[model samples]
Target: MYRIAFGTSGWRGILCEDFTFENVKVVTQAIADHVTAIGERDKGLIVAYDTRFMGERFAKETARVLAGSGIKAYFCKRDTPTPVVSFEILRRGAAGAINFTASHNPPEYNGIKFSPSWGGPALPETTGDIERRANEMLGEVCYRELALDEAARSGLLEEIDPRRTYLAELEKKVDFAAIAGLGTVAVNALYGTGRGYLDEPLTAHKVSVRTMNMHRDPYFGGFPPEPSEKYIQDFINLVKGDPAIRLGIATDGDADRFGIIDEDGTFIEPNYIIALLLDYLVRVRKMTGAVARSVATSHLVDAVARKHGIEVIETPVGFKYIGELISQDRIIIGGEESAGLTIKGHVPEKDGILACFLVAEMVAREGMSVKRLLERLYGEVGTFVTKRENITLSPELEAGYAAKQHQAPGEFAGLKVRETVTVDGSKFILEDGSWLLFRKSGTEPVVRLYGEASSAERLAAVMAAGKAFILG
Candidate 1:
């Protein structure tokens, strides 16, 4: 029997392998039990999925399990975005939400993401309880499930479409009036759940927009449904080839992560986007609050907070920590370097649809390309370059990785170390304001190295030195 382990997000495994139907039922039952224990079973739970193969089937199965456990299930009529699911959780005051999505992972992969009543990713405590229950019931017919039709007849299930209400919420949060006059904008759904959410609002506002990959394909056009720079070169080419295209925006499989392309065909890094948006929200929108970012994120956010006379809260690698602050109304924005972010007034979940719209509104109001806006921000608060690399470790190095991170060097790359931070990883803040972080994976023979500096040249040197230090 496979141990049902939940990672930073949720339990993910390849289809027909560890993520079989039997396993999903076990996990759903575990969740149902958890809800009962928490005394929130009467509030009902939302069931949603993305555009992956067997998505709706998996959703129905999950709902059946919930119904069998005597919990009402709110079923989405179509494939839904992760953020939209979060919105529904809060909108209906549901007990929680069970989303069947692998996020940006490959097509062959599928998983479950659970959000509690707070409408953010479940913390370790919740997932730990579910995991323990699931593993205990493995390999036994330990779960009961109600058929979809039977559940509906008994009022244990209700179908819903969240698109209209979700878009309406966007109109209130985003300045659609500003984006109306912007020139033609390009959108790439990447064959995921972002098709209507990202493009519909712009179209409804009378903004000229062109969209690609609107049709759903389980294969995701032969690539992982991620909007990263390397994975979205076709979108970059589209923006580069057309002078009429003012900007390009994209979202991942579940519409929880965003990617941006400048008018001149430059792919803006998410790190820089976070910092730029942070500054824009403080200066233009007049929003007042501190900001939150992952420890692996760029410190340029710190510079922006400094300029605005606000605080910067750094959390561990997961977005859940940042989401907690958002729930508490402690930050104007919270972001991860992995392209996830949410605002203070929004649901405590990453909203790629919201992120793209914010970028468009910023461009419209500023009357400048994203590149120019970045250059302008760079001038205001010194420049920063950030990079992340994964280094495969040999058996010997892997065995000693833990020991290496604990022993921090006083000097690295010929620069004096100013501070050593061990929040999520071992980060050495150099005297020159540059920094390096080393985090080794517990399940894999690899280490993730993150580096940031004031210049590209310095970043390159720091990355190399970090790799060397890890190997040695």
Candidate 2:
């Protein structure tokens, strides 16, 4: 039997092979047990899904399972974004949320993301308990399911649409008036739950918005519903062909990760976007607080923080750690290199809709394309180049990787290793301000090699040296 394990985000598996109805029940029951044990079951939980295959069916089944456990289920009426589910959990003061989404994963995959009462992704200890409970119940009849009608009759189920409330919340955090002044903004939802969540707010604010992939398609236009450069070529082409479109914004399957294209149709890296947004939020918005970023993220953010005289909090490679600081109002913004981000006074989860709108507002008010703004930032703070690669290891290398990671090298690509950081992985900070990180994927049999330097050539050299170190 396949073990039901929760990774950095959640527990994901192939739709029919491992993420079957029975497995979903087992996981849901495990979550129910965890909630009950924590004494939070009385407050109830939010059950939501993204626009994936059989999404609603899975959500309904989840709600039935919650109801059968004699726990209240605040069921979302339709497919909803991950951040919206987090918003609803805090808005209603509920126990937590069970979000059925695989985020940016491919079509054949689905996942269960559990958030506790703190309105962030569940921590490792909590997920570990749930995993232990789920594994124990794998072969047993783990869950009791109630009919939807019976669940409603017993006052255990309540259907909700979080769009309006979530949008209203964004309206408060983002300056829609500034974005409305822009000539045109192009958006691509990539045929996921972000369709209305990303576009509707713009329309309501009287912004001239052009959108694509707004319809529901389980196949996601034959590509994964990720908004990254490789997965969103059509949107890139559309923006490139149109001069009127000043900015292109896209959101992944669950609207928790953002992708940005400049007026020149250049896909801005998330590392740079985070740094630019951090600068904008502090300099223009006059927001004052420390900033948080994952260790894998570019040091450009740190440069910006130093320029603004704010401290930087470096965390492990998970939004949940950053979310913890956000929940406590300890940081003005928190982001990761993987396109996940959240701000203060918002849901303690990544909100791509908020990030997109904030970018629009910054562009409109600054009167510059994203590229120009990036260039300006580079001139002010020193330039930084970053890259990440997923490298598959041979069986022999895979077996020895754990031990190798512990032995920090003295030099890489001729640069002296100044320090080693083990926040999330083995990261060697070189003498010249460049860094390299090697992290094994929790869910896949691959290692993520991340490198950053002051120049592209240096970044390439650093990455090559990292690869060589792994291979040797």
Q: Against the unseen true structure, what C-alpha lDDT does each candidate score?
A: 0.93, 0.92
Over 4 Å off, model 2: none
**Clashing pairs in model 2?**
none
The C-alpha RMSD of each candidate to the native structure, in angstroms, is 0.8, 1.0
Give the alpha carbon lDDT tens digit for every residue of 140-239 in model 2: 9969989989999999999889889888888789888989999789999888889788888888888888899999888899888888899999999999
Q: What clash pairs does model 1 have?
A: none
Per-candidate total of colliding backbone pairs = 0, 0
TM-scores of all models? 0.99, 0.99
lDDT: worst 10-residue window of model 1? 404-413
lDDT at 339, model 2 = 94
